[model samples]
Target: MQDKTTLYSLRKTIGILGLALPILLLVTHQDLLSSMSHYYYTAGGVFFILILSAFGLILLNYRGYPKQEGESFSDRLITTVAGICILVTVLIPTKSENPLGTLFFTDYPYLFGHESNGFLGAIHLLSAASFFFLLGYMSFYKFVLNHDASASKNRLFRRSGIIVWASVGALIIIFAIEKILKINMDEVFPAYTFWLEWVAVYAFAVAWLVKGKIHKDFEKMIKTFQTEKSLKKH
Candidate 1:
């Protein structure tokens, strides 16, 4: 019952965020319409819709893994790193110009005009990319790679990897197309590639929220590996 409650909470949280992201962007950045003069409002509108849809999907599918014993320390460390990356990417500025600055720097360019500077900008970009990669890898591992084992009792972990991998693949393909076509991603795709890029982000966030269960699962896998190793030594 406790596990169910936690899972429900996790799903609710993610769903709310997913639903809110688009709304927040729309409400706060409505000026983007005029700022990015070259693009049609349809682009931004569609992107916002996509963001809400992605979150809705997350809310609908929030069943996390159960706890296991004997997890690896490295798993926890990597998860932490990935979480930080995701946070930074979401909170920090992607370009030289800070969004907050616009409040005071009223004269700033209306769109795509801000230039991020120095290490801060670099860190932001690096963190953003790393966040995506870490998210993809972790989700692939949990939902796809480790979904099933001969000895594991939990069935919820099964088939999850496929979902994560599919989402990752979709993101990669979308990114590639955006780059290849030089679609003026900002104007063409609408608000960060239709918010598809954020799925991995939210997935990772869910992973963190359920870290205890995830850690246990990792530990169990590690113990299983060790047991197999010991048996081989006999």
Candidate 2:
């Protein structure tokens, strides 16, 4: 059990650092933002890689855990929708000449100058909007609507939401300052937006960690139910 605890602690630390290092590098090395397109592509790659690594840790930890009797249909559905939204975001860059030329491969000039009439351009914008909406909605639902105040399992959810929202608020404040005060921090910190975006990502990761804890509690509840039934039958 101590070993398991240590492993989880390590995973959480890595997850936090994975979200932080990229931002720190971007902020400290703002010159990199001159190549914004490349920075975004690199950031996206890093995001996906980190997500997969986190998932792998989760799978390892849950190995041999008993499955719930019934499938969580809502969870599965939302996950599928989120996955599709992410796929659309990726495919749009690969297929559309506009996004492809600007974001994916910089071999050619951005003919549209970030405003393309191409089908893929529209798809890309739509995908991004949808991605944000879905995440926001899902986060609200999981951390707010379904939260049980009396349950100790819900503490993580509450704390994760607070952290994620606080980070998001900070990012928004920074953006407002840049726009209103004409303070271009980008000159000093390349890829500022990319790094700022990670706050939201980091929030999601923390939320996932909390969710994992709640899931374990749910699993325990299921086991207790099963045990009670078995004892009654004896």
Candidate 3:
């Protein structure tokens, strides 16, 4: 059997990738996220990040099934819906790029703006929203609700859940203000809501990391597991 440390290391890497992916999106520096739409579907890094995030969520789902009463069906359904949202979120391009522009190689028809994207962008937005909201809901309500863990671990889960839900609230407020005032999100915020998005994604990443104990110093645990494995070999 693989040691605890190695398993945690893998989980930690996935969590960090989930957290860092949006920050990578921040570096694109394009004039319009609404226009460019996550640096275009052709951007390999962005695309990879989505796939990684979706897979990570799937991993989390597998880890989430608890032997608790009355939690199984709802948890499974929610996780399934969230995973589907993530998948669709990845498959649906945020917006297309102009054939005459830098992203022409993507070969998708050019969509100059949100209006240009039209129905497709709407679906993308819905999927993205569902993904975030569902993850936050799962964190705040379901995760650790049944897992009998120590006080400190439960506290960690609670704090992570709070952060995840807080991000969702912040996004709602930001969008509400933008729409109510009829101003662009970029004009109101430094990174044009990217940081808002980042917090949500980071929260999603972090809650799973806590659940998986990915950040724990697993030396003692690993040693114990190794000792038990060697005894079994006899």
Return the top candidate by TM-score.
3
TM-score per candidate, chains pooled: 0.43, 0.46, 0.69
Q: lDDT per residue, candidate 3, 69-119, as tens digits?
A: 665446557766877776676667565533222342244343332324668
> Over the stretch 145-206, how does candidate 1's per-residue lDDT look in tens digits?
34343323222222233344455576557658867986555455454433554454455445
Predicted structure 2: lDDT: 0.48
Candidate ranking (TM-score, best to worst) = 3, 2, 1
Per-residue alpha-carbon lDDT of model 2 for 49-87, expressed as tens digits? Answer: 344344334423432112234524243355446556655
Best by lDDT: 3
Clash counts for all predictions: 11, 2, 0
Question: Residue 205: error of model 3 in Å?
Answer: 1.1
For model 3, the stretches where C-alpha displacement exceeds 4 angstroms are: 1-14, 26-37, 41-53, 56-63, 70-73, 96-115, 216-234
Give the distance in Å from residue 97's predicted Cα in candidate 3 to where it truly belongs.
8.7
Query: Residue 152 lDDT in model 3?
Result: 79
